[model samples]
Target: MTTDRLTSILNGIGKEISNRQLASILTTGLESFVAEDQAILRTGLAPAPYISASHAHRDGITTQIGGERFSVFRTGRSKSRLNFLSLLRAGHEDYIVNDAALDYMRQRKVAPDVIARLAGHPETSFCSQMAWYDHLVRLRQDVFDPSLVREVSEAAIWGAVRDHGLMGNTVVVSDDAGQFRIPNHALCWVHAERLLQKLMPKTPEQTRKLEAIRDEICASTAI
Candidate 1:
């Protein structure tokens, strides 16, 4: 396919699928290019070796674009599903890597085989440690320690007060000003019901009540 056509297809695929999935499709499409003679190879360089079906479904890969490790969720490998959770956690944003070795060659001047070799290099593995450090630093800067604990507490409290009113206010005091102050009763009742189910013997009446609350919560959060 012409570069413009391929680019258009890829852009469309990116909108519908994860990057890893898109990469896999692109790689498969380029397999013929790789198998051809030098004359044909000159026309279309091989897809990045990293973009393989074999590597499609590995775990511990992050979905973050700049993440050193490739995430199956972001990459759309067989192992990880597209993380809808990420959508809830963070808003939509395009994740792209335009400066990778092969891409550079495609746009600028470079030896094709060299580009192929570079694309296949295990650079991601080498950079993972640095990526992890950067992640930690970002977390430290953005998330307050108390806020983390407070979120946990809040989840718990939400469970606790779903049925019964507040026992006490759940306060999350940050190192800085402006504490996360929540009323005791805003706790998720459904969570508490689940805990109760695990802890206590379930009578038919209790089971029905718990199921009703759980269903209600599930309906409210339906996405």
Candidate 2:
């Protein structure tokens, strides 16, 4: 789909929605798509650019245009009544178009004016909304401070603590390279210990010594 097409769809939806409401919907949709990856960062994984899974969710409406995903949030009693949930559950892969026409078409009916308007309009609003959505998605993917501890240097970690008011207990001092601030609730300390144990030397004597050291650290930080 092109930006023009997306804008037209959004504008069509906008006929029944306020600008603020449209913005809210778009924002909410994007946030739901991106939140999981953001939480993963708090796990101390190296931050990497990833696509939001909004397109995959049952409640999401996604269209792929120009190699990017655009999604919208649709909810309400009317949506369910109109067979939207059924379509979603059945995994129908159609883009949302103008509202009244969509409704009419649902019952195997058509309105010429709706089709005419869609064809005549340049789809400027649709294209612009899509551009904004793409920009927001890319921005979120690029800005990962929490999950990607590998990309974060020691100085950056300190800076985050100071600037972002991040708590200390959530941060993990992994090695000399830097300290990582992982999600306190999500950090798998057992996994980290396993990795640390793997770093031990092959010699049984050295392995035993390293195991003792690992035990001490585990005891100190129960999290």
Candidate 3:
């Protein structure tokens, strides 16, 4: 419940701790602390609330140690299954790559010169650099499949997630095929709703029909 204390503990030895280890440590301590706080409140002892439970999963904490940075993102509720996707939906040229992906890229005929160039360009995002490499490969190779780049990239992600316990339970939620290419994926509802709102009927007749349909939906929901 003590955000400052937790933050201090994490920062103190965060550089030495892996994410999984940190998560385990926090979970055990937080669970016990929350349970004790709840018990104390039931006995009418006024205790200052240290942690806002609701915001715990909605906010992220990032820390820098030894010039290397790590970010911890919390998604509300403990999930056995998870949703994975990119934050942006640009073309193949804007995909991000992880450490595992670097080796995969080398195997996929990405040249050493291209890799070295990308390594020097700190301003360019991992995905963008990856896309650029894909373009280079397409131009250099005679027998080339652009889809193979994505497939290899996705496989790399799947392997990492599986190692981290997501495995088959990870659902890919993205509009872009060049993004995460997991087998089980669904369109994001928020995007779909926004797109639906943008679609307006051109004719009065169509508008009238759509309005009626909306009313019918509302009426059914009310019932």
Candidate 4:
């Protein structure tokens, strides 16, 4: 729930309450719960990983565009969905390689392309070839192996969750490759049924049995 809506409900719907009054009213029970000066509420919930074979959702839209979503909410307007991009720097920041790093990369043939801000430019300044992927892959060649990368990424995700104070209460999720890796997660029935779906039945009887089992699982899950 948003603060403005909560404030309206507290005072009265459509009430004109000042920000100072709202802040004081909202913190009425601070002594009972809050111990620190900070009180954040988000993450480990929104922008969580999606590990489905068929994820035809807006999450797919953002991921395909190389955006790491930080906030996703409807604004109740024409353009409603909001998202944040933390790891989508085009080529300007840390991904901008230093000359020594470039020389080292050149020596190892692990070089990224020099990019241009605009067309019709004579010279090029250095930027990542594939953004963050290139950085990880470059590191993979030297330090981080694939397994290490996965571990590090998982750690980073959880760290982000903590940073946002999403884990202060509790986090729950359904089992899927990326989504289920949280601290407290549970198995999802649909994902579990994918196991049976993967089977290549050699006979009609086997296929029939598998279908029946899948149906039963779905019906049970619905309950």
Candidate with top TM-score is: 4
Screening candidate 1 with a backbone cut-off below 3 angstroms (N, C-alpha, C), the clashing residue pairs are 20-75, 21-75, 61-71, 157-187, 158-187, 158-188, 159-188, 162-189
Tell me how far the alpha carbon of residue 143 in candidate 2 is from the true structure, in angstroms, after superposition. 14
Residues 16-47, candidate 4: write the lDDT tens digits.
77767887887788764432211211331334
Name the 10 consecutive residues with the lowest summed lDDT in model 4.
Answer: 76-85
RMSD of each: 22.7, 23.0, 16.7, 13.8
lDDT tens digits, residues 1-223, model 3?
4555565677788555555665677677576665554343322211211111111233442111110121122333332111232211101224434444455456556666645543344433334445645544554532266554444444344334333322233233444232233344444444434555677899999889777766655574354
- The number of clashing residue pairs in each candidate reads 8, 9, 3, 0
| lDDT of model 4 at position 144 | 40
Worst 10 residues of 3 by lDDT: 62-71
Ranking of all candidate structures by their TM-score, best first: 4, 3, 2, 1
Q: Give the C-alpha lDDT of model 1.
A: 0.33
lDDT to native, each model = 0.33, 0.35, 0.39, 0.39
Worst 10 residues of 1 by lDDT: 45-54
lDDT of model 2 at position 87: 20
lDDT of 2 by residue, 95-119 (tens): 2233322332333323344334333
Which residues of candidate 3, in runs, are more than 4 Å off? 1-4, 7-150, 156-181, 208-223
